[model samples]
Target: MIMSHPDSIPLNQVLPIFLQVLPLKEDYEESTAVYGCICNLVLSSNSHILSFVPQLVSVFAQVAVSPVESHEVKVHIGRAFSHLISIYGHQIQPLLGNLSPAHANALAAIAP
Candidate 1:
């Protein structure tokens, strides 16, 4: 429902809350749901989220290297990364480099 009307939503307030979900690692369903929302939000034509891409990349790196995360969740994250790369192209490469080798490789491997 939120993704369906991404343009109307205030990204700044909601996105941070969603970003918190991955680190907490308390609820699998919640984590996956957050990833799903992210995947949808990235694909949506909401330019506002572009400002949050760095933050999103940081969190995605965290998730990519998270030992306990499910493959399904990583798949969702991969799709989000792919969408970001499609939109931002080379701009994303630098951020990926700042990550740990394994994390960077994991994310790179996931994206096209």
Candidate 2:
């Protein structure tokens, strides 16, 4: 059941609208607001609804490269990873292997 999580589309399908509001210089607070929504989804175990953590980790990687993503947005992603590692420390190993040094380094910092 855990492995089948990424087949879910509503999660990815919903993010672009929030992403689009950026490149055009929209409200600064919007990204954090949307991030909070995603955070709620995560804390409630909806994050576990993914096929694997790697796919969601990829989304964070994308945000790292996103020019329109604010520093706050990037921080939001980092915080989300921190939350994940707190409850699911074992899952970070594969995700760290897949991420770039910069991103992987941040994950390391979250380790207990």
Badly placed stretches (over 4 Å) of model 1 are: 20-22
lDDT of 2 at 57: 65
Top-scoring candidate (lDDT):
1
Q: Model 2: residues >4 Å from true position, as ranges? A: 1-30, 47-52, 65-67, 106-112
Q: Give the best candidate by TM-score.
A: 1
Q: Could you tell me how far off, in angstroms, the CA of residue 85 lies in candidate 1 after the best superposition?
A: 1.0
Where is the poorest 10-residue window by lDDT in model 1? 20-29
What's model 2's TM-score?
A: 0.54
lDDT of 1 by residue, 39-109 (tens): 77777746666678887888887888888878888888888888888889899988988888988887877
Tell me the tens digit of each residue's lDDT in model 2 across 1-112: 1123434556556554534443224564566666555545565556433333565565666556666777766776777766677767887677778878876664444323
True lDDT of residue 27, candidate 1: 71
TM-score of each: 0.83, 0.54
